[model samples]
Target: MKKKLSPIIAVSLFLAVISLLFPPSSMAGEERIQQELRDPNPTLNPLQKALGKKGYDRAMASGKYRYVGNTKCRLCHREFFVGRKKDPHVYTYERLVAIGYETNKRCLGCHTTGFGVPTGYESFEKTPKLVGVQCEGCHGPGSEHVRLHRDDASPFGMGIPRPRPQKPKGGKKEIKGGFLAGADNPRIIKRMCLSCHTKRWGRSFKRTPHAFQAAYDLYKTPLPGDEGDQ
Candidate 1:
Protein backbone atom coordinates (compact mmCIF):
# COMPACT_ATOMS: atom_id res chain seq x y z
CA MET A 1 0.00 0.00 0.00
CA LYS A 2 1.49 3.34 -1.19
CA LYS A 3 0.58 6.33 0.96
CA LYS A 4 1.30 9.83 -0.38
CA LEU A 5 3.15 12.10 2.02
CA SER A 6 1.91 15.67 2.75
CA PRO A 7 3.49 18.52 0.72
CA ILE A 8 5.12 20.05 3.84
CA ILE A 9 6.57 16.70 4.94
CA ALA A 10 7.96 16.01 1.42
CA VAL A 11 9.56 19.45 1.32
CA SER A 12 11.13 18.91 4.75
CA LEU A 13 12.53 15.51 3.65
CA PHE A 14 14.03 17.02 0.50
CA LEU A 15 15.67 19.79 2.49
CA ALA A 16 17.14 17.29 4.93
CA VAL A 17 18.64 15.32 2.04
CA ILE A 18 20.12 18.50 0.59
CA SER A 19 21.50 19.55 3.96
CA LEU A 20 23.31 16.21 4.26
CA LEU A 21 24.84 16.68 0.82
CA PHE A 22 25.90 20.26 1.60
CA PRO A 23 26.33 20.92 5.27
CA PRO A 24 25.44 24.27 6.88
CA SER A 25 28.00 27.00 7.47
CA SER A 26 28.36 25.93 11.11
CA MET A 27 29.86 22.61 10.01
CA ALA A 28 32.87 24.33 8.39
CA GLY A 29 32.46 27.70 10.04
CA GLU A 30 35.18 29.39 12.11
CA GLU A 31 37.94 27.22 10.72
CA ARG A 32 37.63 28.93 7.33
CA ILE A 33 38.15 32.32 8.99
CA GLN A 34 41.06 30.93 10.96
CA GLN A 35 42.60 29.46 7.80
CA GLU A 36 42.39 32.87 6.15
CA LEU A 37 44.15 34.42 9.12
CA ARG A 38 46.77 31.69 9.01
CA ASP A 39 47.87 32.54 5.47
CA PRO A 40 51.68 32.58 5.41
CA ASN A 41 52.19 35.80 3.45
CA PRO A 42 49.48 37.80 5.17
CA THR A 43 49.22 41.50 4.48
CA LEU A 44 50.46 43.85 7.14
CA ASN A 45 48.18 44.05 10.17
CA PRO A 46 46.43 47.32 11.06
CA LEU A 47 49.10 48.15 13.64
CA GLN A 48 51.84 48.49 10.97
CA LYS A 49 52.55 51.51 8.81
CA ALA A 50 55.44 52.90 6.75
CA LEU A 51 57.88 55.21 8.51
CA GLY A 52 58.08 57.67 5.58
CA LYS A 53 58.91 61.27 6.56
CA LYS A 54 59.20 60.66 10.27
CA GLY A 55 61.92 58.05 9.81
CA TYR A 56 63.79 60.30 7.42
CA ASP A 57 63.65 63.15 9.90
CA ARG A 58 64.94 61.01 12.75
CA ALA A 59 67.78 59.54 10.65
CA MET A 60 68.90 63.01 9.66
CA ALA A 61 68.59 64.38 13.16
CA SER A 62 70.41 61.50 14.82
CA GLY A 63 73.98 62.70 15.36
CA LYS A 64 75.22 59.16 16.04
CA TYR A 65 75.26 58.12 12.37
CA ARG A 66 78.27 55.83 12.56
CA TYR A 67 78.24 52.04 12.40
CA VAL A 68 79.00 50.53 15.85
CA GLY A 69 79.38 46.88 14.67
CA ASN A 70 77.49 43.80 15.87
CA THR A 71 79.35 43.72 19.22
CA LYS A 72 77.40 46.74 20.40
CA CYS A 73 74.08 45.10 19.57
CA ARG A 74 75.19 41.92 21.37
CA LEU A 75 75.12 43.83 24.67
CA CYS A 76 71.33 44.13 24.42
CA HIS A 77 70.40 41.18 22.17
CA ARG A 78 72.74 38.39 23.20
CA GLU A 79 70.31 35.64 22.25
CA PHE A 80 69.61 37.11 18.84
CA PHE A 81 73.31 37.71 18.34
CA VAL A 82 74.00 34.08 19.16
CA GLY A 83 71.35 32.99 16.68
CA ARG A 84 72.83 35.30 14.06
CA LYS A 85 76.17 33.55 14.45
CA LYS A 86 74.42 30.40 13.31
CA ASP A 87 72.90 32.24 10.32
CA PRO A 88 74.73 32.25 7.00
CA HIS A 89 74.85 36.05 7.00
CA VAL A 90 77.24 36.13 9.96
CA TYR A 91 79.82 34.21 7.95
CA THR A 92 79.49 36.09 4.68
CA TYR A 93 82.95 37.61 4.98
CA GLU A 94 84.44 34.34 6.10
CA ARG A 95 82.98 32.61 3.09
CA LEU A 96 84.49 35.27 0.85
CA VAL A 97 87.87 34.85 2.52
CA ALA A 98 87.63 31.08 2.16
CA ILE A 99 87.00 31.51 -1.59
CA GLY A 100 89.87 33.97 -2.04
CA TYR A 101 87.47 36.83 -2.82
CA GLU A 102 87.74 38.59 0.52
CA THR A 103 88.95 41.86 -1.00
CA ASN A 104 86.57 41.76 -3.96
CA LYS A 105 84.55 45.04 -3.69
CA ARG A 106 81.50 43.54 -5.41
CA CYS A 107 81.35 40.75 -2.84
CA LEU A 108 82.36 43.02 0.03
CA GLY A 109 79.29 45.23 -0.49
CA CYS A 110 77.00 42.48 0.73
CA HIS A 111 79.49 40.39 2.72
CA THR A 112 80.33 43.09 5.29
CA THR A 113 78.18 45.20 7.59
CA GLY A 114 77.80 48.91 6.89
CA PHE A 115 80.18 48.66 3.94
CA GLY A 116 79.51 52.21 2.73
CA VAL A 117 78.45 53.94 5.95
CA PRO A 118 80.88 56.15 7.91
CA THR A 119 83.09 54.25 10.37
CA GLY A 120 81.85 51.17 8.63
CA TYR A 121 83.91 48.20 7.46
CA GLU A 122 87.07 49.48 5.70
CA SER A 123 89.41 46.47 5.80
CA PHE A 124 89.62 43.31 7.87
CA GLU A 125 92.28 45.01 9.98
CA LYS A 126 90.50 48.38 10.26
CA THR A 127 87.03 47.08 11.15
CA PRO A 128 87.38 43.45 12.15
CA LYS A 129 84.14 43.61 14.15
CA LEU A 130 82.22 44.64 11.03
CA VAL A 131 83.58 41.72 8.98
CA GLY A 132 80.24 40.03 8.48
CA VAL A 133 76.65 40.99 7.76
CA GLN A 134 75.40 42.27 11.11
CA CYS A 135 72.35 43.61 12.98
CA GLU A 136 72.93 47.15 11.78
CA GLY A 137 73.03 45.85 8.20
CA CYS A 138 69.24 45.94 8.10
CA HIS A 139 68.51 48.31 11.00
CA GLY A 140 70.81 50.97 9.57
CA PRO A 141 73.64 52.52 11.58
CA GLY A 142 72.94 51.73 15.26
CA SER A 143 75.35 54.11 17.00
CA GLU A 144 72.64 56.71 17.61
CA HIS A 145 70.08 54.15 18.76
CA VAL A 146 72.61 52.67 21.19
CA ARG A 147 73.46 56.12 22.57
CA LEU A 148 69.79 57.02 23.06
CA HIS A 149 69.14 53.65 24.71
CA ARG A 150 71.92 54.35 27.25
CA ASP A 151 71.07 58.02 27.72
CA ASP A 152 68.95 58.56 30.87
CA ALA A 153 67.00 61.39 29.23
CA SER A 154 65.61 59.17 26.44
CA PRO A 155 66.37 55.52 26.88
CA PHE A 156 64.94 53.42 24.04
CA GLY A 157 65.73 50.09 22.41
CA MET A 158 65.10 47.96 19.34
CA GLY A 159 61.65 47.74 17.73
CA ILE A 160 59.83 50.18 20.06
CA PRO A 161 56.82 52.05 18.65
CA ARG A 162 55.91 55.66 19.33
CA PRO A 163 54.00 56.13 22.56
CA ARG A 164 51.55 58.97 23.09
CA PRO A 165 51.59 60.43 26.58
CA GLN A 166 48.38 61.36 28.33
CA LYS A 167 47.98 64.29 30.70
CA PRO A 168 47.13 62.87 34.07
CA LYS A 169 46.51 64.73 37.32
CA GLY A 170 49.69 63.23 38.73
CA GLY A 171 52.96 64.75 39.99
CA LYS A 172 54.96 64.06 36.81
CA LYS A 173 53.66 64.07 33.22
CA GLU A 174 54.62 61.30 30.80
CA ILE A 175 56.54 61.83 27.56
CA LYS A 176 55.67 59.72 24.54
CA GLY A 177 58.28 57.63 22.75
CA GLY A 178 58.34 57.17 18.98
CA PHE A 179 57.71 53.84 17.27
CA LEU A 180 60.29 51.67 15.43
CA ALA A 181 59.01 53.27 12.22
CA GLY A 182 59.23 50.74 9.35
CA ALA A 183 60.48 47.85 11.46
CA ASP A 184 57.11 46.10 11.72
CA ASN A 185 56.08 46.78 8.15
CA PRO A 186 56.97 43.77 5.99
CA ARG A 187 57.53 45.88 2.87
CA ILE A 188 60.53 47.62 4.44
CA ILE A 189 62.14 44.26 5.14
CA LYS A 190 61.53 43.11 1.58
CA ARG A 191 63.17 46.21 0.20
CA MET A 192 66.17 45.85 2.47
CA CYS A 193 66.73 42.27 1.28
CA LEU A 194 66.10 43.11 -2.36
CA SER A 195 68.74 45.84 -2.23
CA CYS A 196 71.38 43.15 -1.72
CA HIS A 197 69.63 40.17 -3.31
CA THR A 198 69.90 41.64 -6.77
CA LYS A 199 70.27 39.37 -9.79
CA ARG A 200 74.03 39.69 -9.88
CA TRP A 201 74.59 39.15 -6.16
CA GLY A 202 72.00 36.54 -5.30
CA ARG A 203 72.45 33.25 -7.13
CA SER A 204 71.80 30.67 -4.44
CA PHE A 205 69.77 33.11 -2.37
CA LYS A 206 67.30 33.36 -5.23
CA ARG A 207 66.18 29.85 -4.38
CA THR A 208 65.78 30.75 -0.70
CA PRO A 209 62.52 32.02 0.77
CA HIS A 210 62.20 35.80 0.63
CA ALA A 211 58.82 36.35 2.25
CA PHE A 212 58.67 37.96 5.68
CA GLN A 213 56.86 34.97 7.14
CA ALA A 214 59.59 32.60 6.00
CA ALA A 215 62.31 34.99 7.08
CA TYR A 216 60.70 35.31 10.51
CA ASP A 217 60.63 31.56 10.87
CA LEU A 218 64.22 31.25 9.71
CA TYR A 219 65.28 33.89 12.23
CA LYS A 220 64.13 31.67 15.08
CA THR A 221 65.08 28.28 13.67
CA PRO A 222 68.58 26.97 14.33
CA LEU A 223 70.82 26.47 11.35
CA PRO A 224 70.80 22.96 9.90
CA GLY A 225 73.72 20.53 9.31
CA ASP A 226 77.27 21.80 8.98
CA GLU A 227 78.40 25.25 10.12
CA GLY A 228 81.17 25.35 7.51
CA ASP A 229 80.89 27.51 4.39
CA GLN A 230 79.04 25.77 1.59
Candidate 2:
Protein backbone atom coordinates (compact mmCIF):
# COMPACT_ATOMS: atom_id res chain seq x y z
CA MET A 1 0.00 0.00 0.00
CA LYS A 2 1.25 3.54 -0.85
CA LYS A 3 1.77 5.91 2.09
CA LYS A 4 -0.75 8.75 2.35
CA LEU A 5 0.81 12.15 1.34
CA SER A 6 0.18 15.08 3.70
CA PRO A 7 -1.90 17.93 2.20
CA ILE A 8 0.96 20.47 2.64
CA ILE A 9 3.55 18.13 1.07
CA ALA A 10 1.20 17.26 -1.83
CA VAL A 11 0.61 20.93 -2.51
CA SER A 12 4.31 21.68 -2.46
CA LEU A 13 5.00 18.83 -4.87
CA PHE A 14 2.32 20.09 -7.23
CA LEU A 15 3.87 23.58 -7.25
CA ALA A 16 7.31 22.10 -7.93
CA VAL A 17 5.93 20.16 -10.91
CA ILE A 18 4.27 23.32 -12.26
CA SER A 19 7.53 25.29 -11.98
CA LEU A 20 9.35 22.53 -13.84
CA LEU A 21 6.85 22.64 -16.72
CA PHE A 22 7.11 26.45 -17.04
CA PRO A 23 10.50 28.07 -17.66
CA PRO A 24 11.95 30.54 -15.16
CA SER A 25 12.09 33.25 -17.81
CA SER A 26 8.30 33.50 -17.86
CA MET A 27 8.18 33.70 -14.09
CA ALA A 28 10.99 36.24 -14.11
CA GLY A 29 9.10 38.43 -16.54
CA GLU A 30 6.06 38.47 -14.29
CA GLU A 31 8.30 39.33 -11.35
CA ARG A 32 9.85 42.18 -13.32
CA ILE A 33 6.40 43.61 -14.01
CA GLN A 34 5.53 43.44 -10.36
CA GLN A 35 8.84 45.04 -9.41
CA GLU A 36 8.19 47.87 -11.85
CA LEU A 37 4.80 48.37 -10.34
CA ARG A 38 6.44 48.88 -6.96
CA ASP A 39 9.29 51.00 -8.23
CA PRO A 40 8.96 54.75 -7.57
CA ASN A 41 11.89 55.86 -9.74
CA PRO A 42 11.71 53.81 -12.88
CA THR A 43 13.68 54.99 -15.92
CA LEU A 44 12.02 57.91 -17.72
CA ASN A 45 13.03 57.11 -21.28
CA PRO A 46 10.28 59.27 -22.82
CA LEU A 47 11.51 62.35 -20.99
CA GLN A 48 15.09 61.61 -21.94
CA LYS A 49 14.04 61.11 -25.53
CA ALA A 50 12.12 64.39 -25.53
CA LEU A 51 14.86 66.52 -23.94
CA GLY A 52 17.80 64.55 -25.27
CA LYS A 53 20.56 63.31 -23.01
CA LYS A 54 22.15 66.73 -22.49
CA GLY A 55 18.85 68.52 -21.96
CA TYR A 56 17.65 65.83 -19.57
CA ASP A 57 20.86 66.19 -17.56
CA ARG A 58 20.45 69.96 -17.37
CA ALA A 59 16.76 69.78 -16.37
CA MET A 60 17.49 67.29 -13.59
CA ALA A 61 20.77 68.98 -12.59
CA SER A 62 19.39 71.46 -10.11
CA GLY A 63 16.65 71.59 -7.50
CA LYS A 64 17.07 75.37 -7.14
CA TYR A 65 13.48 76.43 -7.71
CA ARG A 66 10.75 74.65 -5.74
CA TYR A 67 7.27 73.90 -7.04
CA VAL A 68 4.73 76.10 -5.19
CA GLY A 69 1.66 74.31 -6.57
CA ASN A 70 -1.04 75.77 -8.88
CA THR A 71 -2.77 77.76 -6.15
CA LYS A 72 0.19 80.10 -5.81
CA CYS A 73 0.14 80.49 -9.58
CA ARG A 74 -3.56 81.36 -9.41
CA LEU A 75 -2.76 84.37 -7.24
CA CYS A 76 -1.44 86.16 -10.34
CA HIS A 77 -2.53 84.12 -13.35
CA ARG A 78 -6.17 83.62 -12.42
CA GLU A 79 -7.41 83.42 -15.99
CA PHE A 80 -4.70 81.08 -17.19
CA PHE A 81 -5.08 79.03 -14.05
CA VAL A 82 -8.84 78.72 -14.48
CA GLY A 83 -8.38 77.86 -18.13
CA ARG A 84 -5.91 75.12 -17.25
CA LYS A 85 -8.37 73.57 -14.81
CA LYS A 86 -10.48 72.55 -17.76
CA ASP A 87 -7.51 71.13 -19.64
CA PRO A 88 -6.93 67.34 -19.71
CA HIS A 89 -3.47 67.72 -18.24
CA VAL A 90 -5.00 68.70 -14.90
CA TYR A 91 -6.70 65.31 -14.53
CA THR A 92 -3.95 63.10 -15.93
CA TYR A 93 -2.95 61.79 -12.54
CA GLU A 94 -6.52 60.89 -11.75
CA ARG A 95 -6.70 58.97 -15.01
CA LEU A 96 -3.73 56.87 -13.95
CA VAL A 97 -5.40 56.18 -10.62
CA ALA A 98 -8.50 54.91 -12.38
CA ILE A 99 -6.42 52.48 -14.41
CA GLY A 100 -4.52 51.24 -11.32
CA TYR A 101 -1.26 52.72 -12.54
CA GLU A 102 -1.13 55.67 -10.18
CA THR A 103 1.89 54.28 -8.36
CA ASN A 104 3.63 53.03 -11.48
CA LYS A 105 6.68 55.22 -12.09
CA ARG A 106 6.48 54.61 -15.84
CA CYS A 107 3.09 56.39 -16.01
CA LEU A 108 3.76 58.94 -13.27
CA GLY A 109 6.34 60.86 -15.29
CA CYS A 110 3.76 61.92 -17.85
CA HIS A 111 0.64 61.90 -15.67
CA THR A 112 2.07 63.97 -12.84
CA THR A 113 3.74 67.36 -13.32
CA GLY A 114 7.24 66.50 -12.16
CA PHE A 115 8.52 63.15 -10.92
CA GLY A 116 11.91 61.84 -9.69
CA VAL A 117 13.10 65.45 -9.36
CA PRO A 118 13.65 67.76 -6.44
CA THR A 119 10.54 69.35 -4.96
CA GLY A 120 8.42 67.41 -7.45
CA TYR A 121 5.43 65.16 -7.14
CA GLU A 122 6.10 62.13 -4.98
CA SER A 123 2.85 60.58 -3.72
CA PHE A 124 -0.71 61.77 -3.35
CA GLU A 125 -0.32 62.13 0.41
CA LYS A 126 3.13 63.73 0.29
CA THR A 127 2.47 66.27 -2.49
CA PRO A 128 -1.22 66.57 -3.14
CA LYS A 129 -0.84 69.95 -4.86
CA LEU A 130 1.72 68.65 -7.35
CA VAL A 131 -0.39 65.63 -8.30
CA GLY A 132 -1.54 67.16 -11.60
CA VAL A 133 0.35 68.96 -14.35
CA GLN A 134 0.21 72.69 -13.68
CA CYS A 135 1.88 75.96 -14.73
CA GLU A 136 5.29 74.88 -13.43
CA GLY A 137 5.03 71.63 -15.37
CA CYS A 138 5.72 73.45 -18.63
CA HIS A 139 7.21 76.78 -17.48
CA GLY A 140 9.71 75.12 -15.15
CA PRO A 141 9.81 76.08 -11.49
CA GLY A 142 8.31 79.51 -10.60
CA SER A 143 9.66 80.36 -7.13
CA GLU A 144 12.08 83.00 -8.38
CA HIS A 145 9.60 84.34 -10.92
CA VAL A 146 6.99 84.78 -8.24
CA ARG A 147 9.47 86.57 -5.99
CA LEU A 148 10.67 88.92 -8.75
CA HIS A 149 7.15 89.78 -9.87
CA ARG A 150 6.11 90.63 -6.32
CA ASP A 151 9.07 93.04 -6.11
CA ASP A 152 8.29 94.71 -9.43
CA ALA A 153 6.77 98.22 -9.23
CA SER A 154 4.61 97.94 -12.39
CA PRO A 155 0.91 97.60 -11.62
CA PHE A 156 0.36 95.48 -14.70
CA GLY A 157 3.44 93.43 -13.94
CA MET A 158 2.18 89.93 -14.66
CA GLY A 159 5.42 88.36 -13.42
CA ILE A 160 6.89 88.89 -16.88
CA PRO A 161 8.78 92.13 -17.46
CA ARG A 162 9.53 93.70 -20.82
CA PRO A 163 12.45 91.94 -22.45
CA ARG A 164 15.50 94.19 -22.15
CA PRO A 165 17.09 92.54 -25.25
CA GLN A 166 20.46 93.14 -23.67
CA LYS A 167 23.04 90.50 -24.47
CA PRO A 168 25.01 89.42 -21.48
CA LYS A 169 28.77 88.78 -21.47
CA GLY A 170 28.10 85.34 -22.93
CA GLY A 171 26.12 86.91 -25.83
CA LYS A 172 22.98 84.96 -24.83
CA LYS A 173 20.04 87.19 -24.04
CA GLU A 174 18.66 86.56 -20.57
CA ILE A 175 14.97 86.04 -20.00
CA LYS A 176 13.42 88.51 -17.54
CA GLY A 177 11.88 85.97 -15.24
CA GLY A 178 13.58 82.69 -14.32
CA PHE A 179 10.77 80.85 -16.13
CA LEU A 180 10.88 79.27 -19.56
CA ALA A 181 9.06 81.83 -21.70
CA GLY A 182 7.10 80.25 -24.57
CA ALA A 183 8.06 83.11 -26.90
CA ASP A 184 11.73 82.83 -25.98
CA ASN A 185 12.08 79.02 -25.81
CA PRO A 186 9.62 77.66 -28.28
CA ARG A 187 11.82 74.68 -29.11
CA ILE A 188 12.18 73.66 -25.51
CA ILE A 189 8.46 74.05 -24.93
CA LYS A 190 7.71 72.02 -28.04
CA ARG A 191 9.99 69.25 -26.88
CA MET A 192 8.30 69.28 -23.48
CA CYS A 193 4.89 68.88 -25.12
CA LEU A 194 6.04 66.13 -27.45
CA SER A 195 7.68 64.29 -24.59
CA CYS A 196 4.32 63.31 -23.20
CA HIS A 197 2.25 63.42 -26.37
CA THR A 198 4.15 60.76 -28.27
CA LYS A 199 2.84 57.92 -30.43
CA ARG A 200 2.94 55.67 -27.40
CA TRP A 201 0.32 57.89 -25.77
CA GLY A 202 -1.87 57.87 -28.90
CA ARG A 203 -0.69 61.33 -30.05
CA SER A 204 0.04 60.90 -33.74
CA PHE A 205 2.84 63.28 -34.59
CA LYS A 206 3.92 61.45 -37.75
CA ARG A 207 0.44 61.09 -39.22
CA THR A 208 -0.34 64.75 -38.51
CA PRO A 209 2.71 66.99 -38.38
CA HIS A 210 0.65 69.94 -37.15
CA ALA A 211 -1.21 68.01 -34.48
CA PHE A 212 0.91 69.45 -31.68
CA GLN A 213 0.52 73.00 -32.96
CA ALA A 214 -3.26 72.49 -33.24
CA ALA A 215 -3.42 71.28 -29.65
CA TYR A 216 -1.24 74.18 -28.54
CA ASP A 217 -3.64 76.60 -30.24
CA LEU A 218 -6.49 75.19 -28.22
CA TYR A 219 -4.41 75.65 -25.08
CA LYS A 220 -3.93 79.31 -26.01
CA THR A 221 -7.62 79.92 -26.70
CA PRO A 222 -8.78 82.71 -24.42
CA LEU A 223 -11.42 82.04 -21.81
CA PRO A 224 -14.57 84.16 -21.39
CA GLY A 225 -12.80 87.00 -19.55
CA ASP A 226 -9.27 86.32 -20.73
CA GLU A 227 -9.48 88.18 -24.03
CA GLY A 228 -6.69 90.62 -24.91
CA ASP A 229 -4.66 89.29 -21.97
CA GLN A 230 -1.66 87.02 -21.64
Q: What does each candidate score in C-alpha RMSD?
A: 16.8, 12.6
**Tens-digit lDDT track of model 2 for 1-230:** 89899999999999999987654533443465475557675545444555577855665664446667887767666556555656677888888787687887777877786776577789998999998777777666677566655644343324565543333355332134555433356666677777666533433344366756766656554342343345
Best model number under lDDT:
2
**Residues 21-69, candidate 1, lDDT per residue (tens digit)?**
6454333434543543464643221111123456534544555467787
- TM-scores across all candidates? 0.53, 0.65
Q: What 10-residue stretch in candidate 2 is worst by lDDT?
A: 165-174
Model 1 TM-score on a 0 to 1 scale:
0.53
Q: Kindly report which residue stretches of model 1 are placed more than 4 angstroms away from their true locations once superposed.
A: 1-62, 151-182, 203-213, 220-230
Regions more than 4 Å wrong, model 2: 1-50, 56-63, 152-176, 180-182, 204-207, 221-230
